[model samples]
Target chain A: LQGTVTRKWDINKLLYANNIEPEDVIDRVYNRGGDESEEEDIEEEDFFKKKIYKEPSNEFDSYKPHFSDIEMLKNKWIFDNNNSNIDKEDSAGNSPFALISRRFILSKKMIGEDDS
Target chain B: MAKPSNIVFQTHRNFRIRLILSTLSGKPIKIEKIRSNDVNPGLRDYEVSFLRLLESITNGSIIEISYTGTTVNYKPGLIIGGQITHNCPITKPIGYFLEPILYLAPFSKKKFSIVFTGVTSNKQDITIDGIKWGLIPVLEKFGVRECELHTIKRGSPPNGGGEVHLKVNTLLSSPLTLHVTELPKISAVRGIAYCTKVSPSMVNRQIDSARSVLNKIGCEVNITSDAWRGKNSGNSPGFGLTLVAESKKGWRIFVEDIGGPGETPEDVGTRVAYQLFEELSISGAVCRSQLPLAVVFMVLGKEDIGRLIINNNQIDSHLVHLLRDIKKVFGTEVFFLPDDNVIDQNNENNSILTVKGSGFTNASKKIA
Candidate 1:
């Protein structure tokens, strides 16, 4: 886009300064019509009224949610719409230790047998 | 005060974005060894043409190219945008030049009204319709007003002559911070099947086939056919399709396809239809071509962080380099947080991209 014109930039893992997604929107003009589960759900406010509700999901996290299901789509929308935990471990790339800062790793003064 | 050092770069891999960021950020830059080892080295015709267009719109942009065109030293000046005309090289579609200019014109000191003549639709880049319908609304979200891109004439590609008039008024001192993180689902589908100097009947064939595919999606589909004759059709003979998906939240995704030699109108229709489906299936709020513009605007907006929703599968090697170049020029870094809201809770496919803006205001814009 010239890494070997240098594509090495491709292999370099992204540096998330505050670690939102070890990765990567809409205006929430929320409607109250689909609040069948609002009894068990909590409403959140953004620039507009928004909702956050959990959907049924497998624990290991290998599922690609189909967009055909309206309920599933709504859950995915709410869950992604929340940016509060963007830098958390769940939002990081390597599922487990996604938010481990590169700066922290670089700051670790390791000898590696000190064979300079 | 003394001058700041320039952002040094090598190769032409990411030629356009660097210039765009440099211009928007007003940072001096020096690029070296652009296609240095290629068969015919140095700046290509389109690259030079883009530089010329930049020079035309700005007051004091000093662009210096080495004898071999392998190197360029550009000290960007304030954008003094006004009515201007540019004849782009036929080597590239006008989309190449037009797309980046949209990133700039809003910050210009004067109202930007320009007439660009060249290829309008092609396989290589986003067609003019894509720009008019696709990117403009996205710009609106950023608070830019009075934007218009009109296709005065249609020119397909190779042996080309086309004219497009673009006007962006209401000098925006700075674009609004993008707060859109939840990409609204597409609610309607709209499209255009335009043909110039070809069998007008082909339009129907293209439209019907595209409709065949889109009808399955179950959105209110409307594909309009436009046939341009005589001078308005430009010099080349060609036809193409532009599809735009709109959401209630004003999210628009545009996809275009042009007919190649021996390629049927039906084929063009199906190609573009499938392309739209592919885009819809992907999770990004912005399409591949629109990604650079969206990301850059976020970095240049108010210092507060701007967030965008995108799919990991959408990040190509091109974007990888763009993110790196953005850091070098703007000193702004982007955050990538994964999304695990899927039925399988797959955290890797989707994520929110956050960038703390540089809060750039147009220095040349007169305080009215």
Candidate 2:
């Protein structure tokens, strides 16, 4: 549960579910992996960077992806699945937003049971 | 037969039309209406146009015609057509609220209907009776024939702010020239009373004396130029009560009082007002009719930012509470208009309060 397999599984699914244009997300991830393995002192400019977005003016404009620097969403599925084992009530009482999410999850579980 | 030429013109109601036709052979041609067996739209249009032309020709001329179209009356053309134009229009008249009672007067010129609030400058609290005596007689002098007093709800309980709507039958030289200015000079009296400070007690006493004096006399008297405000800080501080009384000697005496020191005009005003209220009540009882009346107390003083003390209270945070209190004391129909801004701005120790009573039915409805 605490190994490289966890990291590999999370990044792969995040890369697919977000439809991150495989070429862009993977290329950046691979480039970052390469920089980590190498001992070379890479300049900030040399590091792989996510794309920035500009405001869309009108309809028919292509859907643009947000290349967020803080990639919490990159490991969202793995983090959530693993944390499922933790007591939800403890986390829910910590914050109001979490309480809302906890209620949503509970309602969804109830609906899933009804469907089954 | 050759077709007649078609013409068209637009005109307003009460327009006249005329026509003249001459043959080239030096003989006059007779004009006659053509009968159309079928419904011809074009023919109808042509007939209308011909009538317009006829109207254009006959304007202003007093000419006799054998027959004319329903749309046009025959007149002389010489008086009708010109290359010039002019414009004139009439507007509706505005209304005013005269105090301490509200009297209806025709506007000098009709512009638009208007409703305005009037506040008495009297600093003391005046009563309904005092106001009736102080104000009614003056209105009678201005030629007000009769007055109908009103309360909040018609025939409802008495509220100090009862309203008085004076039926003004002052005839003007001509209806065209609406004459509203002839009503007893209420503005003049109100102007003096509102700005001046006089005790309510003295005002009532003066009104009583004036009533008796006029009762003793048989002729009408016009009294003016008495300082109704508190003491010149000199001579017996005058009474603020103004009244017209029938004297035992067959004369009407118009009496007014200015004020003096050590007397509260507010108390006197309230007392005199009570006298009028009683009289009104008696009149209603005798007639077996319901009377509607209201009293509005507008107290403007210098406090924190010139608070407008409406009915002796501030516009505190809880407005519903304030309204409930007012309703309990002055009947459900009373209203208070405050001027807190003026009070807050002025650092003066003295403040001005106006207590006005009028018929309730006539009072303007307040929009929350």
Candidate 3:
């Protein structure tokens, strides 16, 4: 009489010995909608009360191309990233949108500009 | 000079890169919250069979949709490509309608040739052999030399059917200057592995467990197994793989995996060889599903300055809403760079994006 393998079947121990719920077995094998009550009807303090508009610390020191604002220059050229004081020494008669706002301030002060 | 109307957007992200950049920027969009907070919301028989394959390749296109398809609108006419043949909607595949017909098949005015039955490989998109080995050689490096795709059968998922065809060859009267900025050296590692109504030794046990984990990373894979049968195998019983790699200057990467419901052809060949060795250990020149077709061919190429170097955490949210709809439809901005020694040692995904293009011409009708 020798028999003792004492339980170890894994897939997280046979999903915890079959009370299952790995998102109800991945929502019954992927028909999907493992319902978490429609994600608790969305409200984690409305993402900490949203609001992040920033940009005006002297709007790039008077670089106003006709008081720009083509929707804030297309949301500061697709979502502002603080191009460190763009002034690449008089961008020779600028405007292809001010030479793409001085090539977005020389792409944040060029770094491996073309790796070499 | 006035003329620059409609262009409001919202939810239902990258809906075919905003209808192929609003049919190549004649503009007119509208969109609204599709799947409006879903609980069976709207717009989904594969987005109304991709708006009936964009109202069968445009001509006085209008579109509309709103009695709860959660708003749409569209407009975009004139892109009159020819021979179409869709069907594709078993909940999306046929590489989600062959990736906006490979971005409006080289600005179609003629030779486009589609076909497309349904579901050709799953795990959510890009797998008609990763658009025939990584997007027809990145649309033949943008000159688009008479493309072709083929694969007339081999569907998967619950009961698809599968077919394929594709053609392309139109653009190039100058425009398309890519400039991939070096990251070459991975000479080989091709693949296929396939399988159909199962057991053709599950495509040689998923190509001998993806060539024993791509021969422990020494590369030179060269897969190839297939198996298909009867009516070129469809009504379900899967298996998959794909891979790609390539490099030696002409780049590629791809990856795919498949084999669902209790997976194991050695767990879909060691998880598609560790996702093609984590996308060839990412030292990018575009790969992250070809960074939105290399940012829509560097925002419709040739105005110049078109650099690449990708991987910044694989940018997603549909490549940040296609870079804010390519700065609201081609005013073209894109710039990023970053990598000042990976932002001074914090090392978050590398960067470099740059762009300037907008010399986007393809004025249609160029057949011969």
Candidate 4:
């Protein structure tokens, strides 16, 4: 309103624009908002929390899954074994006398134990 | 013991006869079809009659025995057929089981007849009807050469198990009498110790050493491993190293096995020795085109030795004595081989190595 047109607003002017007393706002928002307030009943909330988080009748909830049910694959044991069908085919198709003869000649090579 | 004599003769039908024989420890002589007229004029007729006849003929004196085909008189002429049975003593007829047959279909899961002659009987003929034409042989491809062709009798009774029994007689053309006084000499040597926990490399080394020692002493060496083997739990693994060599004297073979591995080395070795001789004997029994000479297993480094002697005609009785003597000489040093007792005490040192019997209570020593 002055000839210089100063822009800064005083405290009284800011308080009037908000349309509420500073004392009344502070008393409602901070002073009366503790646990003691009837609207903020934290103890009743804590009772319901305890009931929801309570343990079920079963005790081994974490131990439900079996170790074997989850598989860890291993390839050596599966692939390294001898082909039994091929062995059977060779024994049946090949000449027994020839096999015996070969065995006689290369006996050192035929030293494997008959486990399978 | 005197060597087995050879029996030979010629039939009027141009068929030749020869029997090289010895007495078996088991069965005696039994003849099926023969008559006094069939016997030669001045020949003795007890044991080894055929042998004596052949011997007399070979003695630079000609003694001939005549046999005629059983002829059937027809209006046009006479015909002769069927089998002719000759009587002679055999060591044992068991040698016949070793005959090798031509297996047509190795995977047929069925055994067929071993036909040596014409397809005259239903029991001997094998027909592969459903099989492809490529599988069966043509007329000219039959097993017999110069065989008389006969029409195939179609409706043959099913050979229950598809196996047929047959009898074949093979005559020698030039029945020469060559006395095989000495058998294929087999040197009996101690087999290597088969240890349960020993590595294969170790066994190989032992075999090599044993072989070198044996060969240095003029024993021929043949090293062969077994085909099948199981866990050597309380027993050792035994095998034989046969050394076959030729010298100025004759062909000689030496064999030894240290029995263990479920069976004793000697057990397996002796069995193999018998089998080799049996094969030769069977060849003699059938009188196939080729026959193997006798096999002798000479036990070395030990006073006691085991011998399994088989000829064309019989398994010798001296084999038992020879085996017994071998054990008595070696004493307890070698156990698993055919022995009278488990622990031989005659040799104070018990230096000769041997395998414990199958039922050995003491745990086998682990040798590498």
- Highest-scoring model, TM-score: 1
The DockQ-derived docking category for candidate 3 is incorrect
DockQ winner between 3 and 4, please give it.
3
Best by DockQ: 1
lDDT of 2 at B187: 12
Candidate 2 total steric clashes? 86
The DockQ assigned to candidate 3 is 0.01
| lDDT string, candidate 2, B234-277, tens digits | 21223344333332321121222223346455433333223222
lDDT of 1 at A81: 21
lDDT of 2 at A80: 35
Residue-by-residue lDDT tens digits, candidate 3, A1-116: 55432322222222222233233333332223546443334333433443543222211111101112224332322311332224332334322223222211123233113643
Across residues B121-213, which tens digit of lDDT does each residue of candidate 4 receive? Answer: 121111221011111111112222221212122111211111122322221111112222223323332232222323444345545654543
Instruction: List candidate 2 stretches off by more than 4 Å.
Output: A1-116, B1-118, B121-240, B247-252, B257-261, B264-368
List TM-score per model, in order: 0.76, 0.18, 0.32, 0.20
Better of 1 and 3 by DockQ: 1
User: CA RMSD for every model?
Assistant: 17.5, 35.7, 26.5, 40.6
lDDT (tens digit, per residue) of candidate 3 on B183-250? 44566778888888877898888888778756543446788888887887878878888878776666
Range of the 10 consecutive residues with the lowest summed lDDT in candidate 2 chain B: B86-95
Cα displacement (angstroms), candidate 2, residue A94, comes to: 99
Score candidate 2 by TM-score against the native: 0.18
lDDT of 2 at B120: 20
